[model samples]
Target: MDKNTTDTPTEYYDVLIIGAGISGIAAAHHLQEQCPDKSFAILEAKESFGGTWLTHKYPGVRSDSDLHTFGYRFKPWTGAPIATGDEILAYMKSVIDDDGLQPHIRYQHTVESASWSSEENLWTITARRSDTGQSLRFKTHFLWMCQGYYQHAEGYTPQWQSMSSFKGQIIHPQTWPEDLETAGKKIVVIGSGATAATLIPALAGKCAHVTMLQRSPTWFTTGRNANAMAEELRLLDIDESWVHEITRRKVLRDQALFVQRTKEEPEKVKSDLLAVLREHLGNDFDIDTHFTPRYRPWQQRVAFIPEGDLFKAVREGLASVVTDEIDSFTTHGIQLKSGKHLDADIIVTATGFNLSVLGDISFTIDGEPLNFGDTITYRGMMFTGLPNMVWVFGYFRASWTLRSDMVGDFVCKLLKHMDANNARKVTTELRPEDEGMTLGPWIHPEDFNPGYLARGMHLLPKQGNKREWQHTHDYWLDKDDFPAIDLNDPIFSYAR
Candidate 1:
């Protein structure tokens, strides 16, 4: 039966934004200011806000990238370069409160599905309200999906054979137990990414013996994750634009230089970096087994834990590294392929997460379901033939917020153009000539699988030079092209 219509208020939001993370909040904040008269609401899935910052609770979780470059240019980092989870969360809250965005947000409203109504020229979004446990729908002209991958805080862990019979308690870093009693307990962390690298040292301080299990090695570098020039800019009493330019330029230059040094003179840079690790581990440690990565530099994300601190944790007897493949689990502990048994009370799966395409939500256009695999990405911003919508996804090669910032401004400009011309709907579709275009594997080839790896590798847009088809991966080029993009181009035509 049709639910009670009298009790439910029927309101129209001009724009509907999904997720309350950094990207979503930034979009909302900008949209709220530009279109105050137009109704808008940010529909969040969780009870409270702070998307990734709110979810990731693992110990030693912090940004490896410099905060000045990592954070929003509109909001400068008041503290150190690299910030902890708490500090980042505080910064988000500060932005929300200062902008007075409380009234515009409806928390605990998890969006289940969204479809475009070509007949009505509006997007009907369905969501489940957490508090009342009631189903609600909102009709809006535009939908902004900023809900990132992993669908909140759920980490991925595969089931190993004979693992259930093991006496040890299994834990995932994503949902780390707050009341975990790791003290004096033998712990084994499985996986070799940044999470496992970060957790080993943090848990080592308290646990009796911490062993880091790795299937493959990663290039590790630890440095100050902050912009040095940013601090100097603030002190010099220079203009904000000047501060932004100097900071952004220095960061880009440094990152480029780092890539250059590694690629041009591999032996020198490699020896120097490995020497640092070797020195930290002392002469007795095996460099080949413990430090070297299988792939070239930057092929995978380089793990950073503050200058061989994780290695130091291992060297000082706080933690130990075990490079092996898991064979099976015994009643007391995990058994490696080499017939070595590691007795442990707890096992942490620092495995990884699923690469969700548009946050695992299905899109439909005019009663027809949209298949992402069949469609090619348009200019790395919008998808082909998906009318009246633009999805903003950040670049993997550079900082996320940097690319997202440009996307946000471009959208605002598009909205302004739509308003001026009295347009009802706007959509960007790739030119027919650009169909069937492919891109390089977003995930490392060795790590490729049909499940999680397929989405990122197969669906990511190809890098190009044309503003419409190009993904320059250069910030200056994006700023020049996107900011000056002509919204009234014949390809993106307005409808009555």
Candidate 2:
């Protein structure tokens, strides 16, 4: 079916995936393997396939999580666990090529609004060509929101006092310019998250001197890129696929224990993490002032630095860290409350991102505007009152694609079950047992509270007290919980 930028109606499919990222790709694979009869197409907003990987062109941009778990379960990751953006994109392209999913993907097709018609029992989508400025329409039986959570157009940069006073160019890592000169420049990178950690190392030797300016410290874990278990297995002449599966399970088990340790013994966990930090910067560096984090481990994401590159850059004098409040921005540099000033020719704001609710798409159900915040979630994937729709919002603590794979299985299974029952409309409903259940924020701040999530909490859907109603960030629990979901459960409302 050809996508018409004109007013002509396009061919309808059994399923329509919203993005061509990892989640969308995984969904396509599952639909082909599990729901063979289901016809589907992927609508991508970007000019290419990779979502975050394609958008983020910052130097040293790489996977925050290892590729063994981050990569699709069906695909064998033969490269290093922590892969580069190019490597990950190549891996995705391989999936697209090998699976023959290219023709189904329409790039630069940005979906602007979606409406679900009960009378017609179908979804009418309004999208625009990012390259053409022309509107198009797509109709499908089911809508899969795999567009991801954060706004990719711009990263969230805080408005510091007197920011306009600074004479140097200010850049965000999310939209890093290709032509921006870095050689022999004195740069100051604000924010101590993963982006800052990655950019500081890549910009180290290139810049005259780079300084990482953070109001507070963030947790970082150091590790080598290679997986020793997978290496030993491969040495025994085992198949690469088997090695990938075995290595992925072991890594996930280790991550689960690490998450448990962070909660059960936060101080011990903090001590172990600090010990790793000390190994990089030595015992004499001001670890307490500049490296020590105020919050408990895992409250925010702990960035993994390959061989402690950021700290190595700091120790070797290529980069420096400043732990002080920004009093104001001066003409040449930032003014610190401690009466210290640092010179910078360029400022990189590595501040996180803004969370986007359902890709910022205006949705309507039965001709009435749908407010996602007014609805409750079903295991963070499906929502109440939204029939025949599933949103692939992935896990925060674990590799994002882990849940994407899980949802792929769940969606395919549910579609088959609906087929068996001959149902056209299916939506989630609060069970009688859940009548008095407490509804909370999308994610508990205690479990995870990154700056973006904190700022966008109210804009997200509500989570109930039960397992069936919340977005459980725990992948270990969900691996079992999702497969055990009964198709005939009272929480599911199905209609012909």
Candidate 3:
């Protein structure tokens, strides 16, 4: 590691990873294990680690997917299937400590821009030190982006008329107050996404009453907190590695089958989900208005409820769901388009996230600004016409870490290949033969319509009709294709 005075600035490395979050750590681990001789560093915009897990500290914050699948493949998660924010952060800290990744991580180094030189076969990156407000520069052969998709600065919150007239406190879950006082307060939470689902049950017990207001209902599913198979294996004193492997495979298989059923038999899957909710909430509940979504299952992510806690809260009258459009906010509460008014002492907005690609970093290739919208995504990882750069984009259908692990491994493999061939740079460019291929959206509009992605579609990279240029949400397809992909393909051109 080299550090110069603010007067003169520039450092170089074999690889420079942006974001010290889950994906960034995974990338670092793979690079270290696969290419021990190579030098690398991790630059994080935040002052600490854990990325999303660390950023969100709202009540009932936990993983929607099972930890076994969400956790890294190299590291085994010994906790319950659904882990809390603190537990996940602890797990990541352990990985960093165990792997000695602290020394290589440079927190508060927010990258502002990157310029790639074709003749030099290197990238010049400019970042700002958040603490000192000093400009820093670095050069690297390869750039690895693992900053996840969502914008961390702020979540998506819609503007409501007369919002400031309300005398009570208004909060967004992304910026939850540490000393928030909610005991016996009538709380109204806006939005029916995962955050609202998780917060409703959690705040119900402490608040006078918690109401979830949604414009439309979202699909919700129940999952157990503990893993029965892992518990059984533990009782038999089986090896920890063996237990983790068995449980991980079992969870993945079950999840994959469920996703497959949802795609192949939408009606059956929807009915099953509604039946489970009806059984938990009873016959008198308005299941259609509050539980059933108009869209098909898996069009958006299905919110997970551990042990039916949300349903149980609603059943016991601690919480309620209000399906209505917001006309506007009243001084005391929110007024619905149906002429109903809700009285609340506090309002919490759990709207959604603001999606961003590559951490919103500016890019210039050969002194020319690179517009991602004009570029096509190559193999869902690399961008077409981009050289020595890879972005870690996880699966929307399955656990995020599953795709993270694969991208990390693939990067390692590419690095090894480059070293063996003595190539200075590897670039993915559209070939002349590929000119006939049809250009399409990165993701199918109907497939996934999360608010963040919908709002940021124009800024993201496009996809082609061909498989090599498209991103498949299926983990099974990516698992078999990513590692086995021919790096020497005509689409990917290498040069010394």
Candidate 4:
């Protein structure tokens, strides 16, 4: 019953989930519902639950994606569409409390490495305790990696020239210090990604002034926080779960149509986005200069500016935007490539994340080091040559949890099938039909090219051109396709 202590003999579990984040919680819940007989443990590196929500502590921190879709399918998100970090933590807590998942989660256990034994048909996991610096070991029949994609320890801060010359404090949104003073201070936030979009408005009124400096403009979508459909369903006094499912489907349909338009009628999509920005900033503001992006809509993540709050800050003169490259950092602030300088008391690098490959945990197969890049992904969940494991790599265009929920069902079903067949191992590899299949980067850059993924693509597994070989990321198609997946397909290699 006790978790590993004092480097005790390796504990064993039917499953070891590598995080307590949204995906991890969903995975655990599925296991509870579908495979109750299986012994499992959730290893979380943080002191508590809520992975992304717990790690990020900046002001106005919230979900860029709406909660109805982001929240688990089994749960009901009755609050506003865009929820704050605290609200998200509350939602996650309710799920854990309702499911009684606390006893299974071991916090502060940072998984350092994993090694697979082909003969034993198990994975040996090594973890270091943040609290006691104690090394722990565990053996598991399956590994569910829900640790999330980005490096949580530190946010990615680009090395601008002469960074040492800056006199003021430099902060990254990922590790926002609670004690750092922001009242009446002049601030410059670099990058126009979601983090920057979320931070500027939150810091605007409190600070003397805030300026968003970006190398180039990024596309954005602004709307009210409320979901009218959800409100309407609640008025009808329907069950909360039914209301949630109804609203979720409506939103997803809208998202699919929106994504379709972005590809088919990009110009119209661009015009509408710019029109919304104009309505917020007005004709006097140089919208074309500061708000226009080089890429089409959804090429990168489109930050949701609830009610145009960031734009309101700009209109009120509390914040401003400077679209220029950084030449260097000066004693006072940043030197722009346009021969201008931005002076600030504090600089926040809202510069996005450094993608972590497999939680940055070193892996070996039978005493030999493994390179993920060597293997191609099998539907973006399982990889070739990796057995009895599934990583929750969610959708970029849709809510992340949707894929996680789907993958959860897949893994649970897989476990039960293994049990029924009296099988010990399952690994996927390309079939003879895939011999001439062309392999490529994890994600085709042209379809979506966010900065974080672009930087870390090399560390990820490859993808084949075939449907089964890629993380489709198309929830609409995958919704049906996933359930119909043949377990006895030639691609799957099972051993007893």
Candidate 5:
């Protein structure tokens, strides 16, 4: 809430963490607890914390994944499995307050560029303060990038024909108007991703009719808001820690099993998903046209409907799905390719996000501009040829926090290792022998097909055929491999 109050002429820290989001907060906690003597600062571009949770405020905005695994391992989530944006924000704030990280947080300080100096063995960071329009400079031994991998300035909205002529109010979920009225109005939501799935059910209660207009169908799984296993454990007088542990492991196991089934037996998985939909919407609803997707499950992230809320809204006739391409936006509503016009008072575009890396900040090392596409990813957390830097990227298949927490811990280990050895710099580089290794995209082109990732894949770091150069999405695999990673790997060059 307050601006950074440092009175030092030149602020120098051991570590400078960019972005005060979930990853940044987790990193702060780890540095505070593990490396107690290390000095660090958190630079946030936004006025507030909570990152994605705080940015999105559309109706029915909530977590797609359960909070048990999504939450930090050090913090126990006592709320429901799927929680609202406000609930998640509160949880993040509680962590910041409990960890006493408020003093370290510098809000509205956006990093514009970072330059690493080999001679000085430090990074000189330049940031602009939004409120005062003044440049601030800082130096640090290590730089930790925790800004999420997305362009926060704008969401991806396609240029539909004749959009300007529409009389109805148009809205994007990322920048929902504070005072826009939706009650008693017909609403048309575009796209079939998690955002649209969340908005439809949330707006159905107040709107006259909510229609989900999708070009194609996406997979959806049903889940309860409350955790039944946690409830049972509480009834049995079990401690909160034990309950959290049990629920977290069970959820991870279930998710891994489902992903495995989708890869090995996609048809069976599809059939089971559709069967749940048929049971909820009854035999009358057109499941094939709206619920079935061409790609296998887990290829794109699966949408979760809390307690069948979306299906219930559809079954009750308050909300419906229309799978059709849009021809153009008419004066009254949308004109579809199927020779149908959807009359609506409001149009909500939940299309998708524009993906970015390190909040699109520029980077240079020793006067050479850094192009991320030319570099390879090291352990999915650090970039090849980047020294004293770590980027916090989480698992796509599991809770984001699971990998983020590990990244925080791993960074502390790196810092301590450097301290014990009296080393000044540690850099991960592609070795000469490893030059012959086959290079691949950060994410295999065939593995995941999310719009944001696909749109911005070229700008991200690459991975190699070898194990160390690749990012493993499996939490269980990373849990065993990341901690024990040899700090003395030949690829890592140490200097004093």
Candidate 6:
């Protein structure tokens, strides 16, 4: 309860964490073990605890991947696999409560800037309270940034030309207006990712008609969101560790098998996946237009629904899919490039998120501006020139939490190594030969918008391994090698 410790330069905390989301929470949980006396404060932009989980509450917002590997490894989920937003939020809140982490959290404090001071060996953080707009400054020796991309919790909704002229009310699923009534209205959902897929089905049941508008195709799959195997294990008299291992391996195997099979032969995999989707949709579903995806299976995040509920909604005549280029917005509805018009009373734009690096917050080391564009990503956790800073960004190819957990473990180990050595700061430095490496498109460079893409391939690490760069996006490899990674190696040195 050290609120408003802003009269003078606040007491120097050994560690400072930005964003109280899962990643930040995990960081604090482990950081305490390494340096128990080191004070740490988690500065959150919002008023509440759950970062993305509480922020995004769109109609069918849930995890596309399984929950077993999507959360902290230290804490296992006792419920279903693909958890809903509410469930995930509750889990996050429980972690805060169970660990007594509320005292470390300072809510409504939005970080505006953080600059490293070489002379003082500390970081000066400036933040303003969201409610009062009062600015405060805090200092920390080590900083961990965990805030995610996306400016607002209420997802992104683009301005369609002449959208205002439309006769109906428009709704972006991200900021779903609680007061706006949607009962018996004709709804048109834009985009084909998880949000669109989830929303189409959830809205179809209540709406008079629903139309899913997609510019390009995306890989879609059907599975039971809930983990049946876990439930069965719970009913039986089995060891808890055995249950965890069984569920973990099962989920991992299922996801790995699907990815491997799809990668072995993309065309056949695409055809078969589409075929399954078509069958789920029945004769009424449009296979030629809706079921086909333009990209390969893993190019983008696939859409998953519990037991083909979206397809069921389509077959039940509650919703339909339209795969066409959007021309523009009409007075009463949308005009498609196919010269077709669809009337809608409510329009939900689920186009996707605007991905930003380091929560799009700019950083500086000493007096020089740290150009993220020129910096090379080291281990997907730290940048080359960034000293005393560690980042937690997940791999798009695998489970997000897998990399997060690994990074978390590695960071804790790194912290312990630093504490034992009495080192104040540690940074990743790349040799000149390691420059000019190209990173894969999994991180999506073009996704940057509204002044967020400060770094490109120059910033991201290379796809393949070359000693200093460990781009092992694989979970199993990380579990095996991450803890054993040489923290005391001369290449990565520490300064007192």
Name the weakest run of 10 consecutive residues (lDDT summed) in model 1: 442-451
- Write candidate 4's Cα lDDT for 1-496 as tens digits: 3333564789999999999999999999999988999999999999999999999999999998989999999999989999999999999999999999999999999999999999999999999889888889999999999999999999899999999999999999999999989888899999898889999999989999999999889999999999998888888898998999999999999999999999999999999999988888888899888989889998888889999999999999999999989999999999999999999999999999999989999999889998998999999999999989899999999999999999989998889888889889999989998997999999999999998999989999999998899998789989998999999898888999
- Per-candidate clashes come to 1, 0, 0, 0, 0, 0
The predicted structure with the larger lDDT, 1 or 5, is 5
| lDDT at position 455, candidate 2 | 96
Per-residue lDDT for 398 in model 2? 91
lDDT of 3 by residue, 1-496 (tens): 2332376458899999999888999988888888899899999999999899988989999988889999999998999999899999999999899889999999999999999999999999999898887788999999999998988889889998888888898988988999999998999999998899899999988999999999999999995789999999999999888888899999889988988898899999999999999889998999999999999888999988999999999999999999999998998899999999999999999999988888999999999999988889987899978899999998888898998899988898899899989998998888898886888788988888888888889988888888888888788888899878887888878988
lDDT of 1 by residue, 1-496 (tens): 4342225655688888788887888887778766666678899988777777788788877766666666776776666766788888898888899888878788988777778887888888878787767778889987777777564547778778799889879998778878889888999999877788888878877989999888766678765554567778788997766777677768777776876676678677777778777777887897778678766666566666675668879889998888888998888889899889989899999888766667666678898987765554545666556666666676544576776677777767777878888898877655566445544433335432333455455555443334566444456567678867778666585787
lDDT of 4 at 275: 93
Candidate 1 has an lDDT of 0.74
Model 4 earns a TM-score of 0.98
Ranking by TM-score: 4, 2, 3, 5, 6, 1
Task: Give the lDDT of residue 484 in candidate 3.
Answer: 88
Of candidates 6 and 3, the better by lDDT: 3
Q: Candidate 1: where are CA atoms >4 Å away?
A: 1-7, 225-245, 260-269, 432-467, 470-476
Cα misplacement distance, residue 343 of candidate 6 (Å): 0.5
**Model 2 over residues 37-133: C-alpha lDDT tens digits?**
9999999999989999998999999999989999999999999999999999999999999999999998998999999999989999998988877
Q: Show model 5 residue runs off by greater than 4 Å.
A: 1-8
Residue 75's lDDT within candidate 6 is: 73
TM-score of each: 0.90, 0.98, 0.97, 0.98, 0.97, 0.91
**In order, what lDDT does every prediction score?**
0.74, 0.92, 0.90, 0.93, 0.90, 0.74
Off by over 4 Å in 4: 1-7
lDDT of 6 at 90: 89
